[model samples]
Target: MRQVPTPFPLSQRIPEETAFDRRELAAILSLYGRMVAAGEWRDYAISHLREVAVFSIFRRTAENPIYRVEKRPRLRQKQGMYAVIGPEGQVLRRGHDLPMVLRVLERRLIRSVD
Candidate 1:
């Protein structure tokens, strides 16, 4: 049988999905757990797409997401790779470090508790 050429080289194969790695997920889950215990969040969904990974939070199952945390590797150079988006589709924060970027939500939690 004749040899068949592969469409793309092994090193050039594009990723099928983008997802939060173990460390990133751990951080996200930590905050999520706290918010849930505080009665500030009820439900959440995680999506791994071709170019972005998103963790969406909802107060109620039927309502829209109250917040969305995203990771885009493509933006790692210019704008950082992690982002927190509010319900209004606004960028609450973005940075190279996930913990630093998530400080905005921590501040919200503090204010709510006060």
Candidate 2:
């Protein structure tokens, strides 16, 4: 009889945690919904890395992200915890509160219909 190979032990695996909490996701999704309704955004991608978490927004699935929302726990003490980056690699906004930090993107939702 052939024996099945066992997987590696848990101790040898990498360990990591997500940066954003449920509340943070809720706030981001809320804004995303609004932007989607306005036809401003089409898709989004999320990545949780060892040092930071990023929420990337794209106008199309095949295109590059237009905005990125990031969370860096290490920056919590110096420059708050959250940051919003534009397509040009500029720091649009940064603050301790996720919602407040995201408000910079929300401002783009405004339009004057003449």
TM-scores for the candidates: 0.89, 0.84
Per-residue accuracy of model 1 over 4-114 as CA lDDT, tens digit each: 986877887789999999999999999989988888999999999999999999999999999999999989998999999999999999999999998899777775434
Q: What is the lDDT of candidate 2?
A: 0.92
What is each predicted model's overall lDDT from 0 to 1? Answer: 0.93, 0.92
- For residue 29, what is the lDDT in candidate 2? 95
Output the lDDT of residue 38, model 1. Answer: 82
TM-score of 1: 0.89
C-alpha positional error of residue 70 in candidate 1 after TM-score superposition, expressed in Å: 0.3
In candidate 1, position 102 carries an lDDT of: 87
Window of ten residues with lowest summed lDDT in model 1: 105-114
